[model samples]
Target: MSGGGSWRFECKFCNTKYVGAHNRVVSHLLKDGGKGVKVCPKVTPQQLANMSKLLNDCKERVKNAAPKSVPLPSSLRNAATSSLDYDMSFTCSNPTSSEVGLKKRKGMGTALEKAFQNNSKEQCDGEIARMFYIGGLSFNLARNPHYRRSYVRASNIPGYVLPGYNALRTTLLQKERKNIELHLQPIKDSWKAKGVSICSDGWSDPQRRPIINLIVANTNGPMMLRAVNSQGEVKSGEMIAELIIECIKEVGHENVVQIITDNASNCVKAGALISAKYHVIFWTPCVVHTLNLVVKNICAPSLQTRNNDDVYDACKWIRPLADDVSLIKNFIMNHGMRLVMFTEHCNLKLLTVASTRFASTLVMFKSLRK
Candidate 1:
């Protein structure tokens, strides 16, 4: 209709005009919503089917004639999210070794793909969420320096190949360990002048084994010395003392100022033995442990009996009031609707009291008050 020589033909069905390319004219008549042009309202099911086949055939002819325009294989396109071997990376670019990211040219997409192209942030967030869900990783991991650093490094490196599993455990592990040790050398060296404290803590493993960890601390910071497994044996003074003595010897007895431990009877006995062995290295109770014990006594007094010796005996109302607060906390937290309402009125989160944590009752009280 636009030109005289069979060019720019008009759709007979919908009266929509287009240049006589079979794809545009047929697709316009087919009422396909994905195409940019308005769909033909008059298109029938039979006409749509025929036009779709014709469009596909036209695409096939164009693709056959233009092989260079075809996208890279799916394997290459998906390389963005997969692990890459280090050998595949270019040494010349000196890109940090990291997770693989796609390196193919970004170009035009279908109408639907283009519609979602601007949602790259959401897509990245979804992938991160999926990873956390699949691995059961802690949400706090997002706050870790290494977690953000890894993403930063990955973004800079395209088509990065991840190190092999064996390399990760053996070669790369040793390399990283050495690198960390090098950085810690100055801190370790400060032990000679600042006089590091040798602190020990005991934890029960899943198998009910007693694991004692020794930490060396100074003005510089703390570092893990080692962990000793008590193998279901009693955590007696002799056994625990032996581990602390070994650590002291390893660290050099002259460099150690004080031995810190929890107020457990066994740990107290161990500290006593260590003090007797080295007069210069005194024994001190862990401050946090002492604070936790004090909080427990004040907030959750014993109910078996009350006498003049009991601290809460004079303040008879403290125990029942504490129990009532605990009940209220549980009531609100256990019900979703109550919790939502509480959040709406007060932004403060309800913190459950924990025996191991210092001042947990005080923290819960503060939250409730706020």
Candidate 2:
């Protein structure tokens, strides 16, 4: 389509010239008894009415809906706010990953008109910048598809009213959820045949509150189910088992094959409870976590009986050695000059064994061996 700002337009149907674009283009297509622009001679009555209703709705929304404040899609807000920041919560519905960055618009009538459009877009960009600054919203939000699309839609309407806060949180939120659910229908439909696995893991957010994340997966791929905050409530085997049962019911018991969790006793108990409740399904420990545990055990110092004075464990030196390695890694990484000197001596950086993941000790040992 040519630029909406063009003062000249040729009607494709009749090859007739018009003085404006956009609304005028719309005005030209449907018969309105020549209200300063000739209506399309070929347009059916039903088509004219439909076009008029669309235009009327566009005009009415600005007058009727502008006073209320509503939120943008949670795909942008929740993803930027909680998901990627703490690195546990996953992006599920309404992903902002679909955003396509803006580009220079095409099909301009002249340099003067193009300059005007460019300047207008720059002003809009200024408003977006101001919005981020004033609201303390993430700059990453601009990357969302809706960020530009909502503005483009608003611009097309003469006096388009923005949705209210109540509408955004209530009506529009529900509407968006339904839309996203429709997109997820294919995955939901595959649940029965393939038998999905229910996987969960624990995390702590920035506030340090515990979170239990759930995801459902088959051969297709993983889909995040939910993230529950276990703040005030006690996180026990029974408590976690309830959550698993709830999820099983939601996904349908027939569709669930197994539940996967860490090797913690409580989680093991939870799995047992789930297995007992749903006879068709079973519980299993995460394979990676299990292997990590094996690595951690292998790296531990050998055990010895305190009653035997003559007995000396073969791995008595290992405990102190691992501790010394950890201390050295920390010291080198914390100091700038020490790190520089260490890097000068060895090209490979020392790896710190994270207590969170047991396999990190193996990685640390590998670095030391180099």
Candidate 3:
């Protein structure tokens, strides 16, 4: 309250008193730089003390009500710990291609400029490590284990290594296999130029898995090797024919002069079709196999019994022993004339068996000789 009409005293803490008219009273009350002042008449000491205490309590309440303090973890020792001033990144005012090498990081979440804002050495190293660990696997950066080691070690990112390794190895294997196939194409082409022969037989391996091998020979020379047709599926004659045709086309049909094989009906039919289409002759079976066939037919019954006993024993003994040059030489040294006669006789028999078409003669000779 003031002495003037409809006026108020101003509290120094809150400058919310009447503006114009209360100026004089405000000045009088706060004469010393707006500090609180007191004026009273017939006032007791107890009353003055009570008034001062009330004013002090009001001031204290206002101070306490200003803003509530945020509770923090007890583990935080410093009160200023809550005032975390985030470090600011510096921007390059001008940058050139020479300063930063040109390469696009496609799947990277942030651009190099953003990742390494001011191009500090530490920041640049961090960015590179991240790129290698995250982008390397996908972009072929971590294809080598050594690169992966360097990246992981530099980045201190052990967690990212395994996934990156798997990605890198898978891509590498795929690439290596593709390259190998490309290199083998030249060998296939060479074989085609010289003409290839086919050797087809149905056989089972130790696991009883039926598979066929297609062998090719040089029409010009004695070089022969297996045919590696990755796309071949040999089920029937037509399927086999397709493989032959593909090989012919690869090397050229004229280069493929002949396909030498046995008289298996399917084999014969397949050869006939190939020869007809490619204008290549199919040669007859080997003479050695033909002799074996003649012998098998001749003594089917009698030789079957003998083959179980004497003939099998004689063959088991003679073939391997005679085939050994040292043994033959030793025999010649011991019985010179007789050994020479025997050698001549064996050669004559072999020639006769190879040339003759009679099955009975081979059987009679086998029985007489043994």
Candidate 4:
């Protein structure tokens, strides 16, 4: 205890002495001590009562010393004392013509008024139509009740008219065709003398229907010429040659400088025939396909070492490694459980298989090595 009747306390945990307040000493013992210091866990009932009395006295002193607020004026006091409830009906002195029109139009209700004021329906319809076109939505999408409800919800503007499916389809299709033609006209005109290269590829669709796609490339850009279904006909060298000739004729033979195709046997024969038929225009196999073939041959196990020399036998060593890689890839891809485990454990996606390209195998191996 200190002089002049002041109380002094010392923390048992840290030997820290505090004067005039046991609370400070308690707080210090609890919070500010080092790891070695053990806190004093006991508090007597008398000490707790003394702390509570001290807190109450401090609060009373603060309340007594605080400055009092000035009394409000009679008018302000009356306003503040008024009840919250008020009459809804009121008189307007000089409302404008627009305000009068709005009041008259208010009979239609607030929801309709807001919708008509914003005109969001037409804007939303245009955007939705654009989204449908860009995403290639099916015609049957409009038949869905959910879709119709969504459309109605979005098109809440007054005087908004929704187009029928047939009308929308006809209008949008014609617009798209006209837009494409307008864009292609300048390109065609620019390439009139320079001529375009025709790149063609054949592939089978999901239903096993063979489709031949032709793209004409010039300085402007590459534009699709056509996609022809050749499923029923024999896909022979002669048939492919005839197809190429027909495409060339349609594109104007004088405007086509070169033709490109994959190096398949039929395609090779077709190119030869095309060159023979049109001496002015050149025909060549796709360079990418040729390089892919070269890589395939280099990596093939059939490449035998002629002499036991390391230089010539390098491929012989690579062949087994490639075969092992292919085996590993097949093990991971063919088994669903293993595939999931591989993805989870390795944190990587396996390379997608592309049967037609040898480069794909090389890429897969490289990814696996990484």
Best by TM-score: 1
Kindly list the per-residue Cα lDDT of model 4 for residues 296-324, writing each as its tens digit. Answer: 76666453545545745766666677778
Error of 1 at 212 (Å): 2.2
Q: By lDDT, who's the top model here?
A: 2
What's the ranking of the predictions by lDDT, best on top? 2, 1, 4, 3
Model 3, 1-370: lDDT tens per residue?
Answer: 5454555545444444543354344344333234343332334567556655766797899999897532222211133435542213333333334323322223222476457543454445555555656555464654768776875585686455444677668987798878977876665667645566555545555665665555556544343233434334556666656666665675566666677665566666777778778665564554555666655543343446454775566445433432353343455547969767877766532222222344544443553355
lDDT of 2 by residue, 85-183 (tens): 321222222333332111122333357755676534644565566679878999889789998898889989998899998999999999999999899
In order of appearance, the predictions have TM-scores of 0.58, 0.57, 0.31, 0.55
- What is residue 293's positional error in candidate 3, in angstroms? 3.8
Pairwise lDDT winner, candidates 1 and 3:
1
**Which candidate would rank higher by lDDT, 3 or 4?**
4
Off by over 4 Å in 4: 1-158, 301-312, 334-337
lDDT over C-alpha atoms for residue 277 of model 4: 90
Deviation from native of the Cα of residue 133 in model 4, angstroms: 17
**Against the true structure, candidate 4 has what lDDT?**
0.71
TM-score winner, 2 or 3: 2
What TM-score number comes out for model 1? 0.58
